[model samples]
Target: LAKTTQPISMDSYEGQEVNITCSHNNIATNDYITWYQQFPSQGPRFIIQGYKTKVTNEVASLFIPADRKSSTLSLPRVSLSDTAVYYCLVGEVGDMRFGAGTRLTVKP
Candidate 1:
């Protein structure tokens, strides 16, 4: 499993763009970067994923550089309801480990 490093907390205003970056210095070539968003009392949901370069979905975007040592999760036009924890994971299927996540607070 690849260890991930991310901020403990972040803040953003309504309608603002929020970017949370995760570092995985020891990622393997077969690993993929996956991001998940979790609201209070709810399970974490998948946001975006990429092996290299960028992948965008209706909810968020994931950016991975050529080296794939790090990734960024970009959330556009966030609202108060978007306040939650964000997790960055690097692994192949069935080899992921969930650790502490980045807490995002979206204010009005």
Candidate 2:
């Protein structure tokens, strides 16, 4: 199992960019880093993913270093609606596991 680590919480204001980082010291060569956003009572929502370097989508951008030991999820111009728990999973598609996650609170 690929264990992950992340900040317990983060605070941001509306219209600001928020970057949350996750660390996985033992990430395997075939492992993929995927991020998810979840609201209070909702399931996790896929945001962005990357195996290495960087990957960007309409929602966010995921950046991974060449070493692949860590990754950052960057959310641009976030709003209050973006306030949620962000999860980082490491490993293959169906074998991925979630850490505690980073609770992001976007203030107006």
- Find the candidate with the highest lDDT and give its number: 2
Clashing residue pairs in candidate 1 (N, C-alpha, C atoms within 3 angstroms) = none
Residue-level lDDT tens digits of model 1 in 10-85: 9999999999999999999888898988888999898888999999989998889898889999999999999999
Worst 10 residues of 2 by lDDT: 91-100
Clash pairs (backbone) in predicted model 2:
none
TM values, all candidates? 0.95, 0.95
Assess each prediction's global lDDT (C-alpha) against the native. 0.90, 0.93
Clash counts for all predictions: 0, 0
Stretches of candidate 2 exceeding 4 Å from the true structure:
none
Candidate 2 global CA lDDT score: 0.93
In candidate 1, which residue ranges exceed 4 Å CA deviation? Answer: none
